[model samples]
Target chain A: AQTVTQSQPEMSVQEAETVTLSCTYDTSESDYYLFWYKQPPSRQMILVIRQEAYKQQNATENRFSVNFQKAAKSFSLKISDSQLGDAAMYFCAYGSGAGSYQLTFGKGTKLSVIP
Target chain B: SQTIHQWPATLVQPVGSPLSLECTVEGTSNPNLYWYRQAAGRGLQLLFYSVGIGQISSEVPQNLSASRPQDRQFILSSKKLLLSDSGFYLCAWSSQPNQPQHFGDGTRLSIL
Candidate 1:
């Protein structure tokens, strides 16, 4: 079974600063996908970014990027120029590209952007 | 242009009462559907997923069950709700395997 681990339960950063959320996963498969989702107080789950394990270039979406180290099994999300809107419960999820369509998620890390 | 809709943004039910939550997707066909339960601060726990109509997969053993009568409609139901079932229920869909899933606003289910 694949399991994702988010070591930091809570993180805080000042507006206009940068923050990184740590994530690691245990999986035997080499080809897979990793995702970061943000859930605000509205309780709406929004996709932040995604990375394919086979790609070493990493994935960047505006202010959000991921440091995907396949060998280390670590996929961390970095938010630059953080805004108040970035405050939310961020989750790291893993998915196998083998047609399972099942996403294993980490516990989550609550991020607070201090204005 | 795909969109997912989850009805009854918020629901409150008494313990032992029957429960129903509906999720439907539009602008796509044969898309994978999933149901997840999010506790207070915990991550989303996948409860059910379907690859096609009438095909459902259960991820956890609980009183809750899921059904997929239509190609794009996924329903979560329970004969008797438990207080433990109180949480935010979310419905999501993906175009293909390992694809990033698009989520609905979600339904907050409170079982008293």
Candidate 2:
């Protein structure tokens, strides 16, 4: 079984600043995928960024990027030039290559953007 | 241009009442479907997933049950509702096992 952990429960960042949310996971599978999802008050889950375990290079999507350390089992999300719209509950998820399409998610980190 | 739809947007039901939530995908075929429950201020909990029609996998033992009647239609049901079952129900789909999942708007379920 794979378990994801988000140590930071709450995080705040001033507008136009940068913020990093930490995430770690315990998984025995070598081939897997890591994802960051954002949920706003609308309750819609949106994919922020994703990183494959085999890829040594981190994944970046515009202002959102991931610092994936496979050896350390750590995958952290970094949001640059943060805006008020970035305020939401962020979740870290884990999935494997050969198995069910089910994803195990961390408790989540609530991000607050201050103007 | 694949898209997922789930409904009703909001639902309120009494305890012991039967429950059913429907999810459908468009512009895709033979996609993997999933059902997840998100408690308030918490992460998503995977309830069920299906790789194909009539192939449902349960991630957690709970009061919920899922069915895939068609290639693009997935349904979550319960014999009776419970207060613990109250949460936001999300439907997701992916083209492959390791691909990133696309999510629906989610259904807000309130069990009284």
Which one is best on TM-score?
Answer: 1
lDDT of 1 by residue, A33-112 (tens): 99999988888889999998889998999999999899999999999999999999999999997867789999999999
lDDT of 2 by residue, A50-78 (tens): 99888899999999999999989999999
In model 2, what is the error at residue A5, expressed in angstroms? 0.6
- Cα error, candidate 1, residue A78 (Å): 0.8
B2-112 per-residue lDDT for model 1 (tens digits): 899999999999999999999999999998999999888788899999999999899999999999999999999999999999999999999898999999999999988
* Number of clashing pairs per prediction, in order: 0, 0
In candidate 1, the residue pairs with backbone N, CA or C atoms under 3 Å apart (3 or more residues apart, or in different chains) clash, namely none
Candidate 2 residue pairs in backbone clash = none
True contacts kept of each: 0.91, 0.91
Candidate 2 residue B107 C-alpha distance from true site, Å? 0.8
How far is A24's C-alpha from truth in model 1 (Å)? 0.7
